[model samples]
Target: MKATIPVYDICTVSDGHQHPDLLTERLGSYLKENYQRVHQQHGHSFYHLVLFTGGSGSHTLDFTRYAVEPWQLYFMTPGQVHSWHLGPETEGYVVHFSTAFFRSFLANPDYLDRFPFFSGQSPDQVMEVPEKLRDAIQSVFEQILQAGADNEPDLVRALLLQLFLETDRHIARDGEPGVPQQKQLVLRNFMALINRHYRSLRLPREYAEQLYITPNHLNALCQDLLGKTAGEIIRERVLLEAKRLLTNEQKTVAEIAGELNFPDNSYFSRFFRKYVGQSPEEFRKSLN
Candidate 1:
């Protein structure tokens, strides 16, 4: 029998190019058959917004899975382990860019604060754009593809900012009144710290102390807006990293455990099994 390879391991782009900017307009038609993009214990470090224009499939990002269908938009943030099981007839346009791209547009460290799509919220708020909005998105891509052959950084940046703003507008129109700005700032800081130290700092109190807030307050705020405790958020972040390491990297469980600051390999195995419902090795085999 032929072996099924994992998607991340094989460069999905044609011409063996890895840069997202270069691959922007190119359609990756072979992604459906080339790999089983599984969410092993460790996740990824890039953000992708996949827009499904036709066909059907199922996608899992973080802990939520959605049935993919026509005219659906899915947001996959950095540090989340996600997988897409495309139908035999799946068709879509995907816009993939790194956080570095945002830096060029916003030019400030706090720029990410403008967008809620990156906040790691559950039931990921992916809006199904109306035909009008869809047309706008397509037009941006058309302009991007037609803007002279030269590398037009200015045009590219403008289109990207427009895309993000449009996404933000949709989110605002759909979402309930979010947490207050001060509290949101605190939560954003807490999230950033967790992203930086998820492997080492597994406790909410660890982050609370660093933020100079009590654990109880942090938990209350997270519970109020996210419907989960702060500790649960931390666990999700840790598990996301664990999934990325297990699926995307070649490291052994013991090596991953040590890196994540688990006391022993067995403990990490138990943690992975509890949340992922599979042993680390079993998850890796499923991807293969």
Candidate 2:
């Protein structure tokens, strides 16, 4: 058997929403209060901005592990599985907000697509805030907390907007500057489409069709930006979902394969072994 991954949702208590469209809390207090929920393999229904001020440890996103240290900020989009292990002395601020919250502030509904780090295709998930900007970032986070406390909705929204713009400046400064704007837009749209349809649309040609681009052009774009063909990108996404499903013991291998739209269980096993270096059963056993 394998451990189940929990998906957490937070809500703005002031207004009753099933899922939290927006929330911000100090890291130490939030972790201490929700101790059981803090250190676990879980996905969220919203985006996260975790600002660490002290202590150290490590965090794992999907299968990749990263150091958890002070002066660094971690951002996560909805549906990315992650877990963390931290020292007892760890302290920080954590902001949780949904795309809807951000959409209300901008004319564009998908403003996050314009931010490189928000696009899942980027390898950059954690960014280190420069020492000079540390104070400024902390101040903004404090204001957000204060606004939440005062129940000032407009102030909270404005503060969050300012925070996102400042963080965008940091991300742009650190990201690859030479990638052309048009290519970036294309790649971003392609990635968004994959996230939306990866479970059912396994073909690069299909994705290209949805994006209104030729398959060859999409392949070239993936190769240029991600050093992988469009097919590889699609396969990687399918493989990631496969791994996530394998952790759910309630779902049999055959059932998981069917849900992923594989032709058959045997074919799914072969594909899993080809990319993951292990059969479905073996992967589950190792986790056990």
Top of the candidates by lDDT: 2
Model 2: worst 10 consecutive residues (lDDT sum): 11-20
lDDT of 1 by residue, 1-288 (tens): 333223332124323434444334422464643354442322445566666778876877654678887777766665566666766677666655556655756658666654666666535446576777887877776665454134565676677677777776654332435546677668778877877788778888899999999999999999977788999999987877676677644588899899899999999999999998999889877766
Candidate 1 residues lying further than 4 Å off, grouped into runs, are 1-20, 26-46, 62-64, 77-83, 87-89, 98-106, 119-122, 130-132, 147-150, 172-175, 276-278, 285-288
Which runs in model 2 stand beyond 4 Å of their true positions?
1-3, 11-20, 98-108, 120-122, 172-175
TM-score of each: 0.75, 0.86
- Across residues 220-287, which tens digit of lDDT does each residue of candidate 2 receive? 99898889999898898888888877777778999999999999999999999999999999997776
Clashing pairs in 1: 40-243, 41-242, 41-243, 41-244, 42-242, 42-243, 42-244, 42-245, 43-243, 43-244
- Residue 195 shift from truth in candidate 2, angstroms: 0.7
Query: What is the Å distance of residue 70 in model 2 from its true position?
Result: 1.7
- Score residue 186 of candidate 1 by CA lDDT: 83
| Predicted structure 1: clash tally | 10
Predictions: Cα RMSD each: 4.5, 3.2
